[model samples]
Target chain A: MENEFSIEVRDLTKMFGGFTAVDHISFEVRHGEIFGFLGANGAGKTTAIRMLCGLSLPTSGKAEVAGYDVFRKPEMVKRNIGYMSQKFSLYQDLTVSENIYFYGGIYGLKRKVIFQKTEELLEKLDLKHARNTLIRDIPLGWKQKLAFSVAILHDPQIVFLDEPTGGVDPITRRQFWDLIYEAAKAGVTIFVTTHYMDEAEYCNRISIMVDGRIEALGPPAELKTRFQSQDMDEVFVKLARG
Target chain B: MRTIYFILFKEFRQIFRNKAMLPIIFVMPVIQLIILAYAADFEVKNLKLFWIDKDQSQLSRQLLSKFEGSPYFRLTQADMSREAAETAMERDEVDVVLEVPAGFERDFLAEKKTQIQLTANAIDGVKGGFASAYGQAVIRDFYGDFLEENAARLSWQPPSGGTINIASANWYNPEMDYKTYMVPGVLALLVTMIGAFLSSMNIVREKELGTIEQLNVTPLKKTHFIAGKLIPFWAIAIFELAFGLVIAKILYDIPMLGNLFLLFGLSAVYLLVVLGLGLFISTVTETQQQAMFISWFILVIFIFLSGLFTAIENMPPWAQQLTYINPIRYFIEILRSLLLKGSGWAELQQQFYILLGYAVLINGLAIWRYRKRS
Candidate 1:
């Protein structure tokens, strides 16, 4: 069924040998929705996201991302989605400008368009002076901001941020969210996974996964009220404990 | 096409930017070519020979003269005593000593009996063998003439020549320059080392640095990525082969008897096999260390069996059979044959076809094993 949602997963499961990582999990993400996929370590969040990004195959069931099947048309899924993992997505040896052009070139952007987009990104991120600085020499916070900007550079239909701000200072992370808000305002669907509860409140909707199953799915305030807790941390603790 | 170009651009940038790897790629072959061609030499020539003649007779003079006439032995002294000859051998100034006892011509004329002694240093077994054999050949020839001269004095009839004369000459490399033979083999080794070691480590480095994961998420095709990785090394290895060949010709006067195009054509196909093997190794290994170990294991086996130093025909039956599977064996055979014997397509078709089949199989396996997902 084609609807306002950009992603629809049905009974998606992944098995390594006999152990099931993601067992019969299903979900839908609306267009331009800021989806915060929340789970404890080893809750199959990575497994599920890998399937949606078309980087991996699902053992059974179906997933459609950007109107493309995750199983049959993974390349199509990859082409339409921008992905950033918390574990350093940019090339360390390449200059800031070089990384931008290289990533843009691989995305099949024309030279002129990559140049134009690079200029806009540099100006927006206030990185005009550090264009030739190697990513290795750049500070961690600036690197994160640059990574986020590059991820959405292609104007992909959806952006997957896998723990994009893990060790950044509070102020830098606050500014990082500002960039996310700017991208969301431009109608790009944001699919972010993070451990921070305050980051959960910023999402339009969130799903808490427990033991390969979705225990709760709703707005943070609704989940807080339903769980009889004041914050997402407590809601997470209540669902994860049982 | 555009994707392939971008990947190539990125790969080239990284390769050139690497400070530790740049000198290894460009400078190493030149050094190895000059040093190993001379260092790895096995052919023995110019044996230093010192002789002591106590008889001072015409017969003893004839024997010493025979050694001087030969091209393989360089005569250092004729009047030196046995003790002096021993000192020369000890000082490493001579490889052999020939001592002729005080046997006048009367012994051969009256009784046809005499004795001579030849001693050789065997520090290098092959060199010693050549020296002893050459010394014996010179003595045997002198004996043949001596027997003919003394035959009339004896009561028995004897023929002019005692043994059948076997005529032979060296072919292909007539001069027997060891460097001429070894330089091509060294070239083969250099190319193999570069293609196998570098290609094996390329993907593993990506895996270690977490770039492979980033690249996998893009719209880039797997074939484009592999090709981009393969092409740069392929070009570098082929360039190394050409560079080595030029050095071999200039330094060693190595014969380039065959078609240069065929050598390069076959090298390109052979590279696919080794590069594919490298890529296969990389796909199976997680870290650069694992890939390096595996690559080294495979390279060692291929090099030993390639007939660079020893002949494959000399190997035992089972070992000879094992050499059939080695890609290096075929390439080195093609290299030596084309470089020395000037072999053509008809002479080298079997080796070429084997490498072609090997290339397809190995590259196919490498591509199949490479997973986009963890």
Candidate 2:
């Protein structure tokens, strides 16, 4: 049977020696959905994303990403997903075009395809003038947008973004979200982790994690009414405090 | 294969763009080689000598004059007593002492043979031994002159059988130029430094910059990543070798006596051993500083044990055995043979095969140690 969910986890646990970093957590993300994974600092959001992205192996549990077992077939999962870390991970010494070319080349895309994608991506972001500019020479906002573009340049089935917009102006953050919405509309599953409560409202569905456990999961409006809160900010604070 | 090519292309672009990195890669080694060539020499000169002659005979005077005439020794006349001469040696004022006993002239004329005691400070043993040997040769030549002068005083008969005389010749470096011996060793060092230092820092820099995280999530194969890292540094180090050789030819007048292709071929394998070692170090280290420290520690040992300055034969049996695994030592041996002795593939087969083994084993281990999932 074809898998309906893009990512599925059943009792995923990761331990470092005696301490458990991620407790037995279970969740599923639907295809083409904007899934907001919300938690306070050290609430196992990053750990969960790492396991699902196939960068870290779970100590015990089952995780299927893009219909491939994360534990048994991580390479297949890797080929089918894209990742943008919280830190600006592109080569600062390299130009924007070079960074895109490198990422696309590593994903085994054809040169002509990469060229076409580069042109389109630059035009869409209105960064045509900054095409040959070094990554370090650009503003933080532009680097973040370019990072997201490079991550999805391979057109993976799912894209994992770990706190991609950590620190940016409100307008830039909103613009960054617009890019995410556009990618989502193209049927790319976006699994984003973030601290900004307002940005969490943009997700179609949200799961609030408290100390490695999913305390709340549903649509944002449903979660707000269930928690008797006005917005995602109050729901997050109430869930974290509990 | 294409993944490796792309990574390599990216690496080269980044390497070429860094303003500091280009000078370090291209210019620094050549400058170090030229300066170090003039400084690293084994030839000892200007040894100080002290003489205390108890025998005031003409023969003793002649011997003292001989020491003064030779350019290697400088005679000190602070005090003629044995105690004073020993004190001078203790103070590092003199390196050798000649003590002639009282009956030297009487016994030499009567008994045809007399002994002169020569004492040398054997602290720097190599220099001390050479100095003492020079003193002995001067005395022997003086003895021959004495025999000629005393030929009329007493007729001496020769032995029936003729004595044998030994003659020696230096094959390639007939004048024993230390520069010729050192240029190839220094060239080997240049390659080792570039291969070890640059590559060991490559991955760790990515880790420090958080770029490795982005790479880990991608579908790049472990073998492909390793090959990508290896190929760029390997090609650069090979270019470095060729460049240094041309500089050696122009500046030092050192000849490429053997087949250039064979030398280049062996150097390619040796570069793998060095670059693999660097990549292996990178996998274990968490930061660029730690990688630099660890590679520096290992490289110091490799340089000292490579027989660049000291002879491998002079080391202990176990240390000599350890040199067998040192890639730099093998390269130095191959280079010296090729540049000085004009050694061909027939003669260099042993070194070539060992390097091949090293290339395979080290690169295999490096690729094995590098994991995509972790």
Query: Which candidate leads in TM-score?
Result: 2
The per-prediction tally of clashing pairs is 0, 0
List ranges where model 1 is wrong by over 4 Å.
B45-106, B109-111, B117-129, B141-167
- Maximum-DockQ candidate: 2
Candidate 2 segments exceeding 4 Å error: B51-61, B69-71, B75-81, B99-115, B157-164
Clashes by residue pair, model 1: none
- Local accuracy by lDDT, each model: 0.89, 0.90
Taking the tens digit of each residue's C-alpha lDDT, what string does model 2 give over B151-208? 6786674333333435578778987788999999999999999999999999889989
lDDT of 1 by residue, B196-255 (tens): 999989889999988788889999888888999999999989988998888788878899
Docking outcome class, model 1: medium
